[model samples]
Target: MLRPGPVEQTATATAVSVGHLHQVFRDAYGCGPARAFELIRLARAALALQRNHLSLAEVAAEFGFSSPYHLSRRFAATYRTPPGAFRRTQPAADAMWPVRQAGLLPLAHLLP
Candidate 1:
């Protein structure tokens, strides 16, 4: 038996019927499935950047990004700042949750 990953299954299902699947994802998430997935990935990446000492390359690899540059570009586009800047601005020992910057939340439409 072969099992497909989330991405594989999404791709396969979309290939079969893109309009229906796209609408379904949009209705559920207020965005297309691919965009929703991207938001989720970037959110996790931001969390990892704050909590881990991993290099951008390592984080990209761990998150299945093709390369550090790809990750940086996407991260910058989503967060409105590069990952290095986000990481550099972290407090010495943050007891509170990381503050969210603009352009980072795709589901903000669901919020107010």
Candidate 2:
């Protein structure tokens, strides 16, 4: 519903020219680049939780979050749980791929 300001757009567009930024920008959606990147970092944090044991501050720095408190606040808003608690309740791996087989299968061969 909100648009990115000039500065945020420039930064995000710059990231788009890079590699993984494409996926991050595409997957992370919010009112602006900063918001989207925050969302991207959140998703990455969620992914990171799959293997790593780190505090909110650690995750925040790794993902460019402004601060641990900032990460905690937004993460609660997004996930409805604290990071540590959320990690404890994680579901099984097979549950992650999606119910649709389409999403589970790699489609790179059909892309070109």
Candidate 3:
């Protein structure tokens, strides 16, 4: 049997329609589920950039990004710095703190 995706599972668990779930997610997060999920993924990518010796392409692939360029675009948009620069400058241990300060940690509970 096919298992429901996260949004469908969330809707079922919360006893709400998928549309309602989307609306609720937007109201709470100021973005739809997809955008929120993207942000969460980017936040994790940020940590990986800081903490790992992986190349940008590797980091991008590991985080489900299409490519290093795509990762750079999203990372720059969200964190105001390219992933390469971030990786070079950020301390590994402090990676997630900046993300937390930027309000990305609210959805961290949804992370695997």
Clashes within 3 Å, all models in order: 0, 0, 0
TM-score of 3: 0.75
State the displacement of the C-alpha of residue 3, model 3, in Å, after optimal TM-score superposition.
15
Q: Which scores higher on TM-score, 1 or 2?
A: 1
| lDDT per residue (tens digit) for residues 1-112 in model 3 | 1112478887898899989989987777677676677777787788777666989888888878888899899888877878888877766545555446546576666567
Residues 28-104, candidate 2, lDDT per residue (tens digit)?
Answer: 43133344434445655666665678777788777666788877787777767777766778733321222122231
* lDDT for position 101 in model 1: 32
Superposed by TM-score, candidate 2 places the C-alpha of residue 6 at a distance from the truth, in angstroms, of: 7.9
Clashing pairs in 1: none
| TM-score of decoy 1 | 0.66
Q: lDDT per model, in order?
A: 0.63, 0.53, 0.73
Clash pairs (backbone) in predicted model 2: none
lDDT of 1 by residue, 1-112 (tens): 1111365476675585666777876676567666665565666667788888999988887766778898899888866679888888843423111223323244433422
What is the clash count of model 2? 0
The number of the candidate with the highest TM-score is: 3
Q: TM-score for each prediction?
A: 0.66, 0.54, 0.75
lDDT value, residue 112 of candidate 2: 18
Task: List candidate 2 segments past 4 Å from native.
Answer: 1-30, 91-112
